[model samples]
Target: MNSAFLFGLLGWLDLFGIAVFATSGALAAARKGQTLVTFAFFALVTGVGGGTVRDLLIGAPVFWVQDSRVPILCLAIALIIWVTPVRIWRAGAVDWFDAMGLAAYSVFGAAKAMQLGIDPVPAAIMGIITACVGGVIRDLLAGEPSIIIRPELYVTAGALSAFSFVALMQTGMDGIVAAAIAFAAGFALRALAIVKGLALPVYRGAAEDE
Candidate 1:
């Protein structure tokens, strides 16, 4: 595949992640019967929070600030959610959308870090950050429990995508192929966790009173 075309494809994946994450954020506000302004605020913060942190940590320019389109897209999504009927969101819709964002963002984040000459380990870490920080911010702002404190697989899924992308790229596989496989793996894991209630084994060390 052409490098420019590959870059464009990756760009689309980034936008896909942003849109879903933003939707989840908007849905959060909607659930609370919030105003359009609040919807937009939640959407913008959750949409760019992760990417902003990633860029800052990687010493790259903040993406949304550099590209007006990012914030505009977020606002547009918020407006859509604001105007749409609550029935559209349905039960568990937010989790599904979040799963999609987590997968795509994880792969895109790792890929971007690799492109920027970051080492594989840190690049993978950037992927996790990209996939998670936004939701963390959203939950905190909404007064919900942090995803990190939950038992179901969430960050683990993101790590699968990020580390898988890095490992695949290290083997000289095509970026597109690597990204697809990684994204699928992450999403599948999260989906299973959502559907089957799969979770990592929690600590069973010493007794609290010990």
Candidate 2:
């Protein structure tokens, strides 16, 4: 795909991912009995943290700052979650939304890196950052353990997807096609991990733990 089309597609996908992240973050804040202000803070961080980091590292303008739409989108999602009946909010849908956000951000980050002429390794690393950092920030704000520190295969899924995209790009596949494949791979892996309790190996030794 052309660069313009790729950028536009990435923008839309990223926005949807941000909405998912914001909604999930809002739910977490609600679970903590936080006020609406807290919910908005969590939502904004979860929605924009990863993209901000990615843009800074790549020397692009911070995304949400340039486009007012991103923050507006996040706020709208937060409002929706905040105003929804508590019973509906408690129905365990947030986890699914979080997974989708992870998949979307992973694809967007890897694609952006490739567009910026970065090497594949860094591109893949960017993808992982994009997928996880927002959640990390939200968890910190909510006083929960960050997902990256968990034994679960969260970051690994992002890495796998990003590397797959990079590899496909190296072989001359179109950016859009590669992004779609990467998103599918990451989402599938994450869903399977959640269902089957898959986790990355932790060190059995004390020294390793230290």
Candidate 3:
């Protein structure tokens, strides 16, 4: 893939991920009956938290600080959610939006890392971090159980997306093709987990009292 084109694509994907993640965060605040200030705070933090960490780890500029549009976008999303009727949002809206963000961010993170000359395994790990860390922070701030702590397919879905994208890129596939497939696979897995209550197998060690 052309480096410029790949970076540009990643930029757009980053925005998409940020938008959905912000929405999820705003929804979290709305669910808790928080004020607009709280909603904006949650949106901004959740939207940029993972990306900020990823950039710092990879020696890149923190994205939201450099991009004026990022904070504005997050605040705008929070305002929209605040004014909208809670009834308009479907049940589990936060999870659905998080799922969308997770898939897109995972691909973007892996691609960006590889473009910056990172190795494949580390790039995939970066992808998972980008996808999941934001939601984890949001859950903690909201006083909810972190999804990563559950048996759900949250991080597993992100791993599938990131690893699949990296694997396809390794084969010289088009970036768009790899991204689409990876995002779809990840989102589908997460959606199935939401709809079907699917879970990873739990560890079954000997009882502590035994």
Q: Candidate 3: misplaced stretches above 4 Å?
A: 206-210
lDDT of 3 by residue, 80-106 (tens): 999998999997999999999999999
lDDT string for model 1 (34-70, tens) is: 8999999999999999999999999999989998989
Best by lDDT: 3
* lDDT of predicted model 1: 0.92
**lDDT, residue 174, model 2:** 76
List all candidate RMSDs to the true structure: 1.5, 1.9, 1.2
Model 3, residue 103: C-alpha shift (Å): 0.2
Measured with C-alpha atoms, the lDDT of residue 181 in candidate 2 is 89
Residue 90 error, candidate 3, Å: 1.3
Q: Which candidate has the top score in TM-score?
A: 3
Q: Runs in model 2 with CA error above 4 Å?
A: 207-210
